[model samples]
Target chain A: MMLPGFPDAAPLAGLGGGILIGLAAALMLLGAGRIAGVSGIASRALGISDSGMSKSSAWMFIIGLPLGAFIVAVWSGGLDAKFAGTGALIAAGLLVGIGTRLGSGCTSGHGVCGVSRLSQRSVVATVTFMAAGIATVAIMNAMGLEVLQ
Target chain B: MIARYLPPLLSGTLFGGGLALGGMTNPARVRGFLDIFGNWDPTLAFVMGGAVIVMAIAWRIQARLAHPLFAPKFALPTRTDLTPKLIGGSALFGIGWGVAGLCPGPAVAALVIEPASAATFVAAMIAGMGIVRLIEKD
Candidate 1:
């Protein structure tokens, strides 16, 4: 179907973006011998240092994500960013932390790398994760929590 | 390995600030942006444009770097095609993004900037991932 954002793009841009993500992930694996899996990297950053190799790489990867995001904020220019409140952000962070632990990977891991590799796990995880996101938003919207509104 | 992260660090910070500017740091803002045409929020497009531009620059820089800080070069995928998996996963992702206004990357980014919904979204996202993994085993 048609996606709301980039309605003109339809399948082309998303698919193109997906391909690029896959390409980047694959390159990381081949060149640096990394998975480009954000979850593993992020989780390891918090803990789970079975080996220094996995742990260190994970930390860098986790750090890279926000770093990339921060640079984007400044270059684009915006009036100071705002948020719902401290409670929500912290609660959200904890949930995400736990979720990554239980899931074994996040969207980057399963959605990007796992899907790229055609791993069955990625397929299932991606669908489930995405669906959950949809469901959560719907319920939250209905509950009148109305974030961003 | 540590050296390899230098690029990501440089890129990630830029990405973060851009998200803040694009309002991606706010899921509500992103959701509103997606509601464009419905209400005409052209804000997200700028973020998309900005990001695409940054990506273009990174692509060029990476290509020129002889040593890429820690590796020879990026590895690309061998397969040059798509399958049922691509279609299904993308469809699911689209619905999620439409509803929550947070894709995985931005969702994680929002988490960092501190949003309550992002945390819930990520939690549900992980639970969803776990369930999928279990089913796949069977």
Candidate 2:
């Protein structure tokens, strides 16, 4: 449950949640024969990209994301989250949108699905983004930028 | 119709639920995980580890199947080349992820938890995707 020296860590919950996510992705892959990459699917749903999947299916998946979270929130009392300022959210959203398009995936696609398959591109992308993320956090900490409160 | 729609809907719902249970929906937890140098939280590593482990098993199963259960063929990515676009885009994405502690999936999943903020991020993300579409069209 709790990690030593890291009082805030919830290892068990993390692992449980992760297994659920993996099962979800596995369902998509096995049942639908799709990768379940959110960005690409979202783009397809929004008509920004013309991938192999149908728009209706994409929309269903997108809708299910919030619906599933809502169910979990209801069952587990509620959910708690902290967000950055409006400016930061917008900036980050834009960067994520563009970057995922260019890179062809995100944490779900590259980190989980791609890495599991041992794809070199996904591995490289995962490491690169992780390094960038860690570096960004370090720089932000050094600057004393309180993005999350 | 059921085969076409049900799988994604179910998968997305499970994905969302998993994110919430795993603490991926919490920006503080995500940022804490990313903040390895300053008060690091290892919760995300467990999440990633578990997901990857399960998926690795799924991949082995995939190698044996000629086609997905409901679909005629697997629509997986085939390109293996490492490109500048991939590295640059991922780095930019990482910066954004670090800045806000939200990615595409979690941002959508959090729509119910934090409606206003999540909506704003999703809208901006769509706009960003649109911008890329415009540039690529040229």
Candidate 3:
């Protein structure tokens, strides 16, 4: 089913995917007793951060991410993606890395896990990031910076 | 060892697959969702909503569990203070997310799908993280 005004929106697919993500996170929490936050996991895997999980275990999870995506891409024909120019990507990546570290989480950690549990910090962080993202996009659009191709 | 490692591997796979299937692997789609003022797409809201709903149930379940089935304990975050670092870092992350329409999860998931671009982003992101580490050391 399509959204009334947003013809491009795939609500069902989004919901299905969301459910799958939720299950993935649930598995992490219930099975391993961890929050499946990609940024934190990546840091731990790289030995940049300390965590209860082993480095090898962290690598396994990180590696599994692309493996799963590859499976879906293969089964679904292919995945389509677009990215900004190298300069923008580098700048953005830097900001993301630093910000997530300082903030202590990213979308998966704070947005999903934190928000679901009604954690005050996560809620505030989510709102702040959302607002910032919206504002950034708006400002970029105003300036005619066509980063998305 | 298998028991210790398998769960996270499975979790990551499911998470990555969900990201791909949810249309989040596509940067344009993510940017579209963020483009609230322009031609906005609400697909991400559904994804977030669905994930949050399921996770909310998981949290409820967590309250009753003595420990994680595979691990010794649940190592969740406990800090509650709202600090400048949190707000500033999140805001910076938001700007970056808006700039590229890619977050860590999708960026990592896209490693196989868009090798060159994803690699570039990931490499830069790692460097960004390194910068934070350096600054924190001072």
Candidate 4:
């Protein structure tokens, strides 16, 4: 069913997708004994930062990200995505990268994996980020400076 | 060596697929969820709920196992101290996410979905991280 005011939201798809994500994370934890924090992994892979995991393993997982997304996009007959302008994208990317590095995790690590495992730091980080995101959006909307179309 | 890498590869693949299917690859959808003040979208909530529930069970299973299947020890975060760095960084991340509706995972996954846009973002993100690394070297 549709949510109250969201005409284009897909709850079912979201849940199903989330299950897959959880399963994937579980596999990483049980099989490799690691939290599948994408930022940490990606940063390590790029040789930008070192979080202890071997660069080989990091690259392996990083490559798999696009591979899996490509498979899904092809199978689903293409996915729809709307990006912000180039300037906004660059600025946002820079902020996300710096912030996640300083915070030590992002949505995947802190939001999904951290919260589920009841990590106090992850919980706090997730709450803080979500609150910040909500406030940012609210403020942007008020200022009529919505970046995404 | 291959054995050590295979699990992560497979997991990453599934993670990417899930992100795509859950519409996390779509900035509009993610922004909709963040826009709680505007036309709020509850779909992303379901995504987070589903993932968290499953992972919660996974954590339970993990507690019983002495060691991981492929690794010698469970390599998990043990830091508990909450610092200004953590809070401040997260706030910056939230602002970025709010502005662009793009996070690390989705941004990387979108490399295939939208190569040019993803490339630009990834490049800038890497540079940002590099800047942090440089500053931290002090």
Q: Judged by lDDT, which candidate is best? A: 2
For A1-149, candidate 2 gives per-residue lDDT tens digits of 67889899999989999999999999989888889789989999999999858899899999999999999999999988998889989999999999999888899999999999999999999999999989999999999999875
Clashing pairs in 3: none
| lDDT, candidate 3, at B43 | 91
> Candidate 3, which segments miss by more than 4 Å at Cα?
none
Per-residue alpha-carbon lDDT of candidate 4 for residues A1-149, written as tens digits (9 for 90 to 100): 66665678898999999998999999989998988899889889988886657899888888988888999999999999998889989999999999999998899999999999889899999999999999988898899995764
Error of 2 at A106 (Å): 0.4
What does candidate 3's lDDT look like per residue over A87-135, in tens digits?
Answer: 9999999999999999888999999999999999999999999999989
Q: Which residue pairs collide, candidate 4?
A: none
lDDT of each: 0.50, 0.92, 0.91, 0.90
> Each predicted complex: what DockQ?
0.14, 0.89, 0.88, 0.85
Clashing pairs in 2: none
Give per-residue lDDT, candidate 2, residue B2. 83
Highest DockQ among the candidates is held by which one?
Answer: 2
Scanning candidate 2 chain A in windows of ten residues, the lowest lDDT window is A1-10
Off by over 4 Å in 1: A1-27, A49-53, A79-82, B1-24, B29-138
List model 4's recovered fraction of native interface contacts, to 2 decimals: 0.84
Tens digits of per-residue lDDT for model 1, A69-90: 5554444453233444444443
lDDT of 3 at B53: 99
